[model samples]
Target chain A: MNNVVLKCQSLKKTYKKKNRKLVILKDINYEFKSGHVYAIVGKSGAGKTTLINILGLLKKQDSGKIFILNNDVSKINENKASEIRNKNIGFVFQSFYLDPLLTTEENIKLPMLLNNSLDKIKINERVKKLLKEVELEDRETHFPKELSGGEQQRVAIARALANNPDIILADEPTGSLDPENEENILNILKSLAKKGKCIIIVTHSKTVREYADIVLELKKGILEEVSRD
Target chain B: MKNYLILILKRIIRDFKSRLVILLIALILLLGTIVSINEKTTEEMLSKETYSKYHNRLYQLVKKESYETKKKDIKGIPHIITILHEYNIASEYLSSEEFKTPNTDHTIQAYTADNLSLPKIKYGTNFPDKQGFYMVCPINMYPNSNLSSNNINFKITNKDRIDMQQYLNKTIQFQFENVNNMNIKKESIDIKIVGLYEVNKHSLEDNTCYINESAKKYIYDTLNNDLPSYIEKSNPEAAVIIIDDIKNLEEVESELSKIGYRLDPYTIIDPNFLIETKKINKTYSLILSIICVFLLFLILFKDTKNTLKYNKLLKYLGAKDNHLYLTNLIHNILIILLAFILSLILSFIYRGLLNIIIYFRPFLFSKNEIIFSITYLFKIFITIFISTIIISILNNVYIKYKLNKN
Candidate 1:
């Protein structure tokens, strides 16, 4: 009975397209617990990114409330939300979004820079540790452009775990990666989930869904758990 | 604060190339605005009453025909330091004109100055503290321009250069002549050469001399004492008006003009007229400052897409809008401060270059005084600072609002 790390109740979001109300998410209730990898599978334009963005606090939900560690965060101001995100949640995206100017080591140290609790020595130590976790110790000085697709993705994962957040939300993490790199990234996410971190990934790949502990299907703005055949 | 500074440095390093272009334009605009304001402030300084206390400039006044300007005529003019009468007397031995013509080149021009016009003494002493008929001549005896090899038979070796120093304590006879209606009267007086002056390095070699005001008056009076009753005693050939302030030149000239006196065409005019008057061109300064701010805004706006993309990325990394706002502010301020320092250095370099060019080739460029006031720099800095703050805050807030809307 892993503790539930994140929960959302009756979530709804809508947008106005051509004078018509288009619903992106409708009355969604979900609980994400620790030590599980949840794959949110949806068709293109099915609001998968929207759901993940709201859960990551990168975007605001138009209606309904969210809870992290049993504390309500829906009414938090952006500053507090940012603090919570920095401390409690991590995000990875399809584009990798590594600061082009930063080296692999520096990119891994980015989120830790926001954590005031970590001194310079601790930050450096954590960066080295994370680089080792991703097996990128040798490539620490290489810029994102210099790294392969898989190596860059590993650096992105290392960056997401920089502050040791309990929840990791990834959007199309393997969308641009090859088959071998995709397998490698999924195995890393699986290892993170085994370490008692809640990993939620939004994707369209069936292999990722099969690899996930629980698969959720998002269709027409509704989310439903699908049975593993 | 350290963390914030590090973040700012990171952001600046990443965007350094794109920001370099904006920095250059900002520097140019800043210098342009500074020049405009310097012009306006110079004009304002000219009109200020306190300026007279620290300034003194020279101008010459020549008496017109049928006009007798006495000391009483110029007494009422404000800012007049002193009116010294200038006299041209014939010196037989001291004048380099002797090489050219025994009669014509002997005319030596003399002036009466209290102390401001005294030349730097290179040898011997300056005029006595209790001055009475004292004179100071040039160290180098420059021949008259007409004393070329073709016209003059005078040839002197370096031995002649040694003889000029011997005249430091010697007395030379100066002839004071008055010619009236074909009547000629001549009086000779002995004046001692007390000091030798070091002439300017850039000036052509010339034998010019300085005499105290009392000596000039004594010679003028000796010639005027024998004049007929129809001629006035206090009338001078010309008067050199020493003004206490350059700023008061225009006003003093106007006052002198009102009293039937005109400045000599060769008189040195105040340099402020080069920038024009405040009423005519001060508005240009304000316009330039406005344009500078607007141009900065335009550059920032043109880069908005990339800036917004970076900001969004930082936001996704859990940065608050406030942090992003501060980062933008610090970035702009850093660029502006760099431009400020660079513009200051460039302006001083420009001033030095202008003076150098004007010094060597006087005909090619007019001499100008380019003064940079700290008050004006501070004022412009504040203007840019306020504008930068407002623009940075507005830009960040707008981006935040726009992102929220999306």
Candidate 2:
């Protein structure tokens, strides 16, 4: 009875490599529901990252229809796409892209800065809540460069949730972390999905697949759901 | 909006140190161009207004031929407050009957002019009017009976000289001579010595005397055989017209020119000259402004490039192109506003320093003084503001393109 937060139909993406048409994804159709973690696993050349980019609205698909919350957003312009991204989608990259000039709290407050509906007091309150949620409330004033790899990733996660996005698209969110930090990030993502957020993660890790509620494998420009005992 | 402004302020302060040196240089350049153009133009305009209001209304009507301008010829010319007719009479024909000392060493010349043209009188005042036989004699020259041999060296004392005061209010007989058709005619008149002028060390003005218009006419009558037909030739050989106001100068000049009288401006400067100088300064300031704009572009370009990483991050965080654009705009505006304020302050300091220098060595700057005005400051602010906006937009476009590409 869970609601479908994101759905894609007949998605197609291609790249030209050395004057040859190389197909990355073709006819990708899926409906992602809330309260679930969808792990997309693939080989190095498989199009897992490309699919996640398309789903996150960070990259344009050559041909497809994308719907978020029953609204068709496949042909919307960049500005509208950005509004959707700000209001509905959040992204966590593997590199942990944090503004070096801004402190941890300021980075978390960045997304809300563009949201006119949120006043200063509400934004500050939300930033503090996210900082505490990511267990970095004590490091709110620390800049990215001053934090450790795990701490920086925690700040990035807090930033990803700044506007309380309904859908989280994480591409190798823990790829650069140690096992201990990776476990911590995975647990946090799992908790977010339990709270009715649609979490889509692109990764090659076996542990992430085990943690996911539904695991999909992308191979040879096709997607196949894998059954686990 | 409040949040956006806070972010902008924080970024500006965070990047303050990195941009400090270039910002300072930009401030100096902006202040230099603004002060240079504004001060120069203000000086030119103020000087012209002062000159035109006080002394530039005098014009000499040149004589084209032996044809003299009759009083009837300039009867209808508006703003002709005065039409001065000046003439000179030889001093050899002049002798003070009561004083009895005649100088054979140097000739003393007597001339007539308007009161405005007369030199500063040390002992008495200028002629009250052109009528009557009034005269202002040089303290060392007239009444040769009073001068000691040492006084001839021009070691003339000031107005308090007792010997010079002796000639005041005294009447002296002037003998005038005329040669007509090989007939020598002579006449004499008694003229009063009313004033004395100080002998200037730099000129031969001490050997000269200033006579009234009536005395000049008496000499003219004696020289022309006292004939009424010779009266036209006796008109002032040269005439000077004084305009009542500056606004009426061109009209009066055109009227005079239309009447076949060639007028030479004594103090009124050519309007074309000022226009040409203004054009040159405008172009100069424009070039400086362009350079200032280019400098700002470079600064913004570098800053945007440096923050390209952050911009990319913001883009990934769902910032629209215009959102990023607005951020860059606010950033640039803050810097430009800071530079504008600093430049204004520095320009005032620059003007103050130049004034101090001029005060110490007045001859260096001469008549032109540095004048500061709010209009100039407003002009400079508008220029830099608009230019910074254009530069920011251009910089924004480039940054937008680069962000999309990356």
Highest TM-score scorer: 1
Per-candidate TM-score, first chain only? 0.97, 0.96
- For each candidate, what TM-score against the reference? 0.73, 0.64
Task: Please report, as a residue range, the 10-residue window in candidate 2 chain A with the lowest summed lDDT.
Answer: A220-229
Tens digit per residue, CA lDDT, model 1, A120-174: 8888899999888889999988989899999999999999999999999999999
Runs in model 2 lying further than 4 Å from the true structure: A138-142, A178-183, A204-215, A225-229, B16-25, B28-53, B56-61, B64-280, B296-311, B322-335, B356-369, B372-406
- The lDDT for every candidate, in the order shown, is 0.71, 0.72
Interface RMSD of each: 2.1, 1.2
lDDT of 2 by residue, B285-403 (tens): 66666776666667767777676776777777888888887887777777777766666667666666665675432432422345555565556557767887888788777887786
lDDT for model 2: 0.72
What's the CA error at residue A107 for candidate 2, in Å? 2.5
DockQ of each: 0.41, 0.47
Top-DockQ structure, candidate number: 2
Q: Per-residue error at B66 for model 2, in Å?
A: 11
**TM-score, B chain alone, candidates in order:** 0.58, 0.51
Candidate 2 CAPRI-style tier: acceptable
